[model samples]
Target chain A: MSEQQKRTEIGEIGEFGLIDQISSKFTNKNSSTLKGIGDDAAVFGSGDLLQLLSTDMLLEGVHFDLSYMPLQHLGYKAVAVNVSDIAAMNGLPKQITVSLGLSNRFSVEAIEELYKGIQFACEDYSVDLVGGDTTSSPSGLVISVAVIGEVQKEKVVYRKNAKENDIICVTGDLGGAFLGLQVLEREKAVFKENPEMQPDLEKYDFIVKRQLKPSARMDVIHELGDLGLVPTSMIDISDGLASELFHIAKNSEVGVTIYEDKLPIAKMTYDTAVEFNMDPMTCALNGGEDYELLFTIGQNDFEKIKNHADIATIGYVDKRANGLKMVTKNNNTVALQAQGWKHF
Target chain B: MSEQQKRTEIGEIGEFGLIDQISSKFTNKNSSTLKGIGDDAAVFGSGDLLQLLSTDMLLEGVHFDLSYMPLQHLGYKAVAVNVSDIAAMNGLPKQITVSLGLSNRFSVEAIEELYKGIQFACEDYSVDLVGGDTTSSPSGLVISVAVIGEVQKEKVVYRKNAKENDIICVTGDLGGAFLGLQVLEREKAVFKENPEMQPDLEKYDFIVKRQLKPSARMDVIHELGDLGLVPTSMIDISDGLASELFHIAKNSEVGVTIYEDKLPIAKMTYDTAVEFNMDPMTCALNGGEDYELLFTIGQNDFEKIKNHADIATIGYVDKRANGLKMVTKNNNTVALQAQGWKHF
Candidate 1:
């Protein structure tokens, strides 16, 4: 290839564009692969059930900063985040394979400490640590985890299943993890400015923990199963709530209208946002990494989960021509925008 | 957590040592995970059959220098190596997930070129491209792939099954890939020193392609089954012949005796080694990344496969007390040594 032909930028095509270009040329030949490449996890059909597979990679400087991030929390976060992808497909994670590339700067004990948190997450999620590869890197650390999960054929969910007038629901709360990251960054800056100053992180512990050790909403998935309800469409909130909403809307060929008054924001998350002079509503809409489940349910199926403690109805699916909109508490309407994480 | 504690160097323990240290602490709780951490791939007992899981990571500088390597070959090699691990387990690869970390230096076109090679490998290996994550990295490219394969319960082979008097065998030829890398490195040095000179890689095309596009020996694995022979023990020849032999011996509690004259060396590889003034036998024994299957078969299964063109009986397993030794054409015995690639 000539030098001029090699100078195109990845950002020009964007992430989704690149994925479309890559996935378009391949065809799945195996009958076992019932679904591939477009969902939270690839679904494989066994005789009586479906097996889910998903993988994620975390780079050192790009994904986390060692100065503020504890190795154990990083380990836990890695497992939890990958498990969240499996949960998004309404599956129970059974096993995970973690591969790590480490530099000599990491000691055996440091690696042990990281594994300790990995073990904790495994136990918490009822998953097994099956296999992994560890090798030396020239610089920094790289972690790639592949998770396997199982679900019944009828229980599996996809992003393109939402219907007209379906109720959009979100579990737990949003923006807390994003707010938590903001607080950690502020404290990191304060510490860097003066050697004598110590980070006063006690008051912001909830948000910080949300950022470091966020849990996947496996409880919501189980409860929905118990209630005999399958979400019309589903996705986990990793790349901000608005971005996920756009994904569901685009894939389902529908629009969404979310009520700000119904948005679930933690008290601490709201107060911290106010302290930082940021809009709490915007944080809930655009803040990411919450690892919470967001989905839409058929109108008749809503009665079963209406009283669930952890779930809240935030909106309803509408015609695409109506567009995505948010209703403020004062009855004013505004267009919803997604400020997704742009790594490039 | 104290700094006063002494640190243990990873080199002291080596790659296997570090892996043993880490894997020993974690126990598998999920019944689906039939085996973990010790073999070429983890065995999953889903039902009547066994599922094999294997993962490998290739870092930019540590694994390959992009300056001399094409992105497409890098992509193809990544998938092939992971598939080779599955082949080592005597299984049929069914699916693979590829996660890539891209830096700003890479363009969308460049990524598409990489995926072109990936799709070609997927087609060649008959594996489905399942799910994967695409994220941006701070520096160079990182590709991590996890492969899923299947084998019958009775057909599965492990590294610990070699017995006394088992015949050791290797597929295809050895040392070509390593010598190919040497030629490429020499050409790279010439190009770096003088920008005017173009690399004359045409003369070394076969060896160079061996280095860049080594295919997994799945065909040999399939052929062995047709011949009604199962390897008592098996491993892929990635970390040189001697090191891999040491692995089988250590795991199986046996020793080996190989003949230097019996080692398979391609004509081109032999001539290139001679041109480089390196010992051809040494190159065949210690050179790595052949992507060839090395196995030990019971004496009863020897006649069934001896006539096959690609497979060769190189040696036999011995008692642990005899140790690993090589017999020269002159009837001189020498202790075998392994200097596998050391990243540290």
Candidate 2:
């Protein structure tokens, strides 16, 4: 009856695409809203310093399946992800509030288990669990966490602060979480086929742990602060390396050139990828949920962090005209593309 | 074969019973956490003032039906409900972070409609929209909002602060929102039964509006501030008045004696309740979603607010030995029972 029969699928736009489209339409009108929607955490202009706030929601079935995922690990990951956002802003997280939608399926013991992990994360990050709401949901579990952190005005890092020739650095190895997920899914399928068969997850424990309990890079944030180094641009690798890199490149008005060989991948992760019949390089490029810090630094600061074991130089910022390209191990240049998680 | 197979239904315990069971388990570890998980919001000690942090989550089907609920109203209601928590704390709301989980069913235009309402609430409260996460859900829409507000150390009110002999006061009126919901549900049924019939809702505009687009009691907070009136204890009437009164009684370790005659009700709400064959008195006591301010003031401060057109003195706080009772029109004393929203 109507001419508007066309329906645009969200999967067509992708997560990053949808974010770009939505964020582009809204402009921050409040003076206190220093930054919005573009960075890992939004920065607010507090009277004395910049206050950073970040929020994240994790849903059951989509984000994590409760059958294989422990309630405690889910709680820990929820807090860690929000902390990761604050860390991406180069700020020290001080407080967090967790809101939970608990279905009737969860017992008192289950909730206690969840809060146990939440308390553990609070102790680890030195954040105060200030406030939260717990209510019943009709189905499934929903956990939402909001973290508050503070950074000095001059030290606050944003995605748009990168300059041309700045070196790109990423903390820890990539692709491990993705490979770990693949291993778990494979084991789950096998177990489903034959209930008598047990999942031999012990051998792939490293990658499995990476997927289940990834830590926020607060240590790196503190280290950089102690060393008097501030990142020129920064974002957390929640939506894969290439997607985050594109965010930096687009926001900072620059192009990036990376060496594929320089990308950090753990040996176990690479082995697991091969076992799954997938390319480790592709996994590293496109896998989400890494929760590692990706940042840009000035050339002069490179000498300061060169010897740091946790930090690795993966790329360099380039002029916008140069475009985003990667030099392969065999000395061949290729255009870099990002294919992030498509939950829609 | 195990003894742990005993499954208990959560509906048996009800929402308040479930909350009481859960709240008894968490002991506050942070010295800055003055109050946690007992009132409308939690109170944390900041250097010179108290920081009020509150969070809420709304799930589709459980909290709202999209067939009758507009996306814009959902967003506004989400913010308003969170801000109402701050109002209950006798605090001025400062900032809010909203996290949304949308299925592919939501179009870009739909999401825009939601944000427009959020922006409207932000402007109304002079609060900044600082940070949030936007991601895809598996099935239904999920909205979670975390709000932060501040109050002077001495001015901050808590549910535990009501003392014996304090006068109970309520802002605006009650039972309107719940009556409005009844009207909406009836219309929805009518539409379902006859597809060609346009729902006759003209006579029930006020009540329907109360259900659809309720405003937070920020005006009460501001007026109290201007009058230099710090309530002895405060709570927003999100749940029915009876339930909230019980909360004050339990938390403050005092008994409440509310006058049934003094309970404020709108004429339209009362007439509509009668037309629907619902008890207006029961609706005032146990019907919820009013978003009105229910609070207690010291006896000495009564002169300051006695002439306020919108506020009514309902009753007074009694000793714990007296218990919670309502004085009926026929001079009969009855115990007040709280029938809060039960999701299970």
Best by TM-score: 1
lDDT of 2 at B304: 95
- Each prediction's TM-score against the native? 0.97, 0.94
Candidate 1 structure quality by residue, lDDT tens digits, A1-344: 98647767878877777787788888999988888888888988577667888998999998888988999999998999999998999999988999999999988778877888898999889888888888888788999999988888988999998888999999999899989999988888988898588888899999899998899888888888888888989999998899999999988899999999999999999999999999999899999899999999999997888898889899999999998999999999999998877777
lDDT (10s digit) by residue, model 2, range B127-208: 7776677777878899999887878888888888899999999998889999988888888898999988788778888878
TM-score of chain A of each: 0.97, 0.96
Which of the CAPRI classes, incorrect, acceptable, medium or high, describes model 2? medium
Listed models, DockQ each: 0.75, 0.50
- Error at B179, model 2, angstroms: 1.2
> Model 1: how far is A134 from its true place, Å?
1.7
Judge candidate 1 at residue B26 and give its lDDT. Answer: 82
**What's the lDDT for all of these models?**
0.90, 0.86
